[model samples]
Target: MASDPWQGHDAAVLFTVLLTGVPTVVGLAVYLGSRLTRQARRRTTPFRTWRDVSLAAAGAALALYLWGLLHVLFLDGQEQAEECERQRPEGTPALVGRRGDFIPLRLVCEASDGRDYTVVIPGYINPSLTVLLLLALLGGVVSLLLHHKQRTSTRKKG
Candidate 1:
């Protein structure tokens, strides 16, 4: 039996995955959004200043990062990694069967402090996303809403 029974919990897995990836993803969005704004300005500005050129370059880099971020967010990752030390299971020098084949998962703690645990990140990964995944997905979709706002503002000013 594995100590970290909660290892396969979907929500935990998804959160861990996204949380790990967010920094890079956000950086890309910023980089791209900045560049995009710059490029738009360049089309209107004949001065062709370094500022516009720089913005365009930045935007390109940002877009590249954004793409990379999305690729990472959608990437396949393991469901869970339960830390054995947290559980403090007893007896084995090294726990058996940390890797390969679906073994039984039992959350056995000893009667006293009982059995601790061994960390297990199952090799098999399920492609299901949890509520966190859904929220992240929703946020991604809702970001499109900003386009309407930008258009509305541009219309009023123009």
Candidate 2:
């Protein structure tokens, strides 16, 4: 029987949870807070659209990150080990061990013959998350600049 790679690594699991969970929670909170505020005010500002788009992008990225984390932590290792065992050359013996990666999340299965089979968290996920994060940052900066400009212009007139 294959042992659980994550078993007995309480610190690592806790760290992973905190690293991903905090951002996810913050992103969702910001998104929901803005939505609720907009509903309460019942008026849209010039920068509101940009701000909302930024928050949406952040939320999407965070969701993807969490999904990838879930796959890495709970699903991939054992399945990939089984696949490796099946795919190994005949008479090569069983899978010997497995290893995991956190960033870009993946599992590597080691066979008795010293071959390694890697199962990667879908190719598009990390890159897509990165792009979304960049979009979110750019949109946030644009929104802030526009908001600041609007405030300054009003101040000058007043």
Q: In TM-score terms, which candidate is top?
A: 2
Q: Report the backbone clash tally of model 2.
A: 0
lDDT of 2 by residue, 1-158 (tens): 22764321133663677587767768677766767674645877658778887888888887777666665555444565565566666666667667665554555666667776555467678799889999999989999999999999999999
Alpha-carbon runs more than 4 Å astray in model 1: 1-48, 79-158
lDDT (Cα, tens digit) per residue for candidate 1, span 1-158: 35743323234544554565466556645654665675665664222333343444443433333333333234232321234334444454442222221122222222233334323332221112233244444444444455456678789999
In model 2, how large is the Cα lDDT of residue 113? 76
Local distance difference test scores for all models: 0.39, 0.69
lDDT at 141 for candidate 1?
A: 46
How many clashes show up in model 1?
14
Report the C-alpha displacement of residue 83, candidate 2, in angstroms.
4.2
